[model samples]
Target: MQFTLDDEPRFPRGKRSGIGIIGCGHIVQTAHLPAYEKYGLNIVGVYDISEQAMRTVQQRFHVRHAFASVDDLFASSDIEVVDIATHPAERAGLILKALQAGKHVLSQKPFALDMHTAQELIQEAERRHLTLAVNQNGRWAPPWRITTQLVQQGAIGEVLAVTHLFDTRFEWVTGTVFDTIPHWAIYDYGLHWIDSIHCWLADTPLTSIRAREYRTPDQPMESKADWGMWCEFVYANGAHAMIRSVGCSQTQRDGHPFWLHGTQGIIRGSILGKGNDFVELERDGISSRYPLKGQWFPDGFAGTMGELLCAIEEDREPYHSARHTLRSLQMTLAACQSAEHNGEVVPYEEMKR
Candidate 1:
């Protein structure tokens, strides 16, 4: 099914908004490209360091222009929005460059490799008065959206705790041992869970985080062993949350499981493998099951993108603003740091200051 904002009156009416994409990697092919196509936006150009990858996307999407350098893509006058899907380590510099060029940016999560850099990038965007957004798309998953609504309506009264578990069994025989695999799990998959948790508990800004990380014995640092991580997040209103992720599960299926418990009710959901998606909400001892629906963009990407377009056209902050993205990023990065330092609880104030 295609994704279009035409049905939403809040979205702008023009199909002429041009979008340029940097990095024609896996996500670009599987998610970003499809999203742009579904939205009916003008994809004016694409750029990647790898010539073969660039050619592959250009041919597959029938995009008219392809550039070997990001510089060239940013220099294009026709490209109004820039999507940066490059590695996390390179995100800050690329985003700054894009913003400096007077273009709106939609970047992959973990907006920066670290909080300091993320702050700098955010400040730059604010200074330039440009739209800067991160792809925390998991919030748009139908199940999560329903959960958000239920919680907001007090179906889940005064959320007390949230437990999120993401477990994926990577078939070692078939998995690629890329050089950046060590930073893969947390930066790649963990961001989705973290972002989703924040969305579910909107008023909570993680106050303190304590975490632990584990890695397999046989894996190289680059392709580190299946790692598992657990983190505790404390909220300002005395709410608490626990997030756990395991990169290598002996279990045959990949499951990103979530259980949210509150004073009045509970919501349980799982995104497992390709077809095993389900959401169960329990309120007042009456349980109802809702089949999950996956959208064209990950979870929150499409809605956030549509909101962003409206914000840009109408001169307002998008629903998922840079400030929100930064808070999520700060919490995740602090978890990583806390884990590395032997599970010491890191305070949110420390990350900000």
Candidate 2:
């Protein structure tokens, strides 16, 4: 079978949109800078709390300027869009500031510290007519994104169930702030799949979620976050998605990480970063396999900035618009609440209200 990326990018090339970045963290160093360069946008300005961090990214990525402070970066007349890659705790303020400054934004998720803050930032952006996008870049992961296309093409008939089990101890924990957060091990890392599953369903509205979270006894005791999460998600259209994750698994092997069963067909693949990484769609007793380019780590980063830039050019909302991702945020938050409430099913309607 011909191997095509999930979708052809319709972003207009030769259009250099001015981009400013706020955080010079791990993601900004690895994915965001490379992706911005790859997608035809230049980082006109950047800011971080540490001058050293700001200078490092500035020189490393050859970014145009390192602002003395975030306010200085925001004040730059060249910057039209601000990429706020700061930690979740700091995101709301940075996002609200950018929105009020009349600049479009692509902030890191979980962008909201909570739904109320999400709504506040969203409303501010809306009132200003500025595009605010969450970097739910998992939607661009090859295997997951490809499966979405096949499902939408009716190759999979209708998506009935998508069960994704990720049972691997993420080895990249030691020297970061992630080691400290309570739910960071589960909710933080697990958010990719949470957001991706929503994307896989093609943004069909969600209805409710029944979720349970706990720490596995055998799991390594590192973070305060639960090491496991079993989520049963119900969509408004009657489709369902389930996520069973063991973030601290030691002995188990996660061979096939995802199984998406549809009425007419099914897709099987692994999203274990940099792992044959193929999306196999089997329908009507025939099987076809499509290969992927790279992991979501860096490749997925492309679409985050690319979509925002294209939306600016097209005069429309980005594919990862903040309004749309607000549902994903609410679902995740409701799942958090439900986990706290002994796995009680949380109706999204109640939370949205």
> Residue 214 lDDT in model 2?
77
Candidate 1's TM-score reads 0.87
Candidate with the greatest lDDT versus the true structure: 2
| Positional deviation of residue 314's Cα in model 1 after best superposition, in angstroms | 2.8
Report lDDT (CA) for all predictions.
Answer: 0.74, 0.78
TM-score of 2: 0.91
Q: Which candidate number would show the highest TM-score if scored against the true structure? A: 2
lDDT tens string, model 2, 1-353?
Answer: 33334543345565677889999988899888887676666779889998898989989888889988888888999999999999788889989888888899999988887878888888999899999999988877767778767766677777788898876765456446776765563367767777777766755777888778777676555545566678788988888998887666664454338988888788888775435466888888989888676566676778777888888888898979998887678777777777778789888777675
RMSD of each: 4.1, 2.5
Stretches of candidate 1 exceeding 4 Å from the true structure: 1-11, 171-183, 216-226, 296-301
Clashes of each: 7, 1
lDDT of 1 by residue, 47-113 (tens): 9999999999999998989986889999999998888888877888899999999999888876787
Q: Which stretches of candidate 2 lie over 4 Å from their true place?
A: 1-10, 202-205, 236-238, 251-256
Query: What TM-score fits each model?
Result: 0.87, 0.91
